[model samples]
Structure formats: C-alpha cells, structure tokens
Target: MASWQEIEREFAEFAAKVRARFDAGTNKTIATVRRDGAPRISGTELKFEGGEVTFGMMDGSMKLLDVRRDPRIAVHSPTLEPPADDPGSWPGDAKLAGAAVEVEESPDSPVPGAGYFRIDVTEVSLTYLGVPADHLVIESWDAAKGYRRRVRK
Candidate 1:
C-alpha cells in the first residue's frame, strides 16, 4: 500500500490524471463489505489533504460499521458523460482500491464527530477511449509492479 504522497512522487503523470478526475465532481461511489459478506455501495465525498485520501461517514452508519469490520474498500470517481460530438474527448474515470485505515478526526474535520478513515492505496486506475476512439484504454498502477497500460477492442 502507498500513501497519496508516495503515488504523487512515484507516478506523477498518472497520479495527476487520477486526481483530476476525482476533483472534477463531488459525489463519488464507495464500496464496502457488509457483515453478511455482500457488497454495499454508498454515495460519498472524498477528501484529499496532507497528502492523504480520506473520508468521513455519518456516525453509526452502515458504511461506518462496514469499514470498522472490514477495512477493504474501493472508491470510484464522479462520472461525466462524453460530449455527443466528440466521444474521445471524455476525460475518462478513476477508481482506487485500498484498505481504509481508521484515523482520528483531524482538526479540520469536515464533519466533526464523524467516523474517519485514510486510504492506504493498493491500486489506482483510469479508463478512457483511445486516440482513435474505436477502442478502450486502461491505465493502472500498483505498489509492486508500478504501472501498466492495456487496450481492449
């Protein structure tokens, strides 16, 4: 796992693309595991600060409970539609998977008294149309292997 700062320094170009996509909008999707071993998706807003990716959950919320029990988590960047006239112009989307380490609320806690956790990122990826707009491209990075790009028809 790597901290956001580490990603920034190690994969500056890829990290910038991921951050831009995440910053493009507010509401992101978060996936957590439930007690019954099922998956739960929840609307959430992510925070980037002090070189850390963090988020808060309403006190006693199902998401909070899930995080407490199983820190494994995944976050999807806000979505944006490709322009009708230029499908290839779409900025693409980002997703990150990691373990959410419980942390004490920071002094500037966006939601005071809420549950807080910091993401120890295991992987980050972005997907978009290739230059020709006829195929799909996926760029992914992990702590162990660094970076890789794959294309699909």
Candidate 2:
C-alpha cells in the first residue's frame, strides 16, 4: 500500500497528469465490494489531502457500509468525451484501485463523525489516445511492478 505522495515522488509527471484529470471535473465513480461478494458502483467525490487520496461517504450509506465490510475498492476519475475533431487533445482519465482505510475521527476529517477514508493505493492508471490519434495508450503503476505502458491499436 502506497500513499498518493509516494506515486508523485516516483512519477511526478504522470501523477500530475492524473491529478489534473481528476481535478478537471466532478462526480468521480467508486467501486466497492458488497457483503455478498458482489460489486457495487456509486457516485462519489475525492479530496486530495496531505498526500492522501481520500473521500467521504454519508453515514449509513450503502457505499460506506460496503467499504466497512470489505475495504477493497476502486475509484475512477471523472471522464469526458474526447473532442471528435481533435482526439489527440484529450487529456485522458485516471483510475485508482486499493483498499480503503478508515480514518477513525482523525483531525483531517472534514466533518465530525462522518465516514472518511484514504486509499492505500495498490494501483493507479491513465488511459488515452496516443499521438496521431491512432492507437490507445494505457499507463499503469502498481505496488509491485512500479510503472508500465501499453499501446493498443
């Protein structure tokens, strides 16, 4: 498990690009595992605080409860349709997958008693159209392998 800052330190440019994509829009998506071992997707927003990738869930919210029972989760940054006229201009979208660690009323908690957690990020990725707007490019970073890139036609 690595903090967002660790990624930034190791891959500053890639981290900045991912952060910019996340900040460019709102209503990121979250994926959590239900008690039944099923998958759940929900709308959420993220807060980048003190090098932690964090977010909040309303008390008793299903998503919150899901994470409480199973901390494994994945988050996707807000996405946009690439301009048809200039696909090359697309900045790409970001995604992070990891375990959600409860803060337990930490000082950084935005609201008292609210369910807040930071991602112990296991992986982070960015996907976009490549140069010449021909192939698709995927960049990924993980705890074990560090960073990797692949191009798809």
Model 2, residue 10: displacement in angstroms?
0.7
Lowest summed lDDT over 10 consecutive residues: which window, candidate 1?
Answer: 105-114
Clash count for each candidate, listed in order shown: 0, 0
lDDT by residue for model 2 (59-138), tens: 87999899989999999999898998888998889999999999766565566557988999999999999988999999
Which RMSD values do the candidates have, in order? 1.3, 1.5
Show model 2 residue runs off by greater than 4 Å: 106-112
Which segments of candidate 1 are over 4 A away from where they belong?
110-113
State model 1's lDDT. Answer: 0.93
* Distance from true location, Cα of 44 in model 1, Å: 0.6
RMSD versus native structure for model 2: 1.5
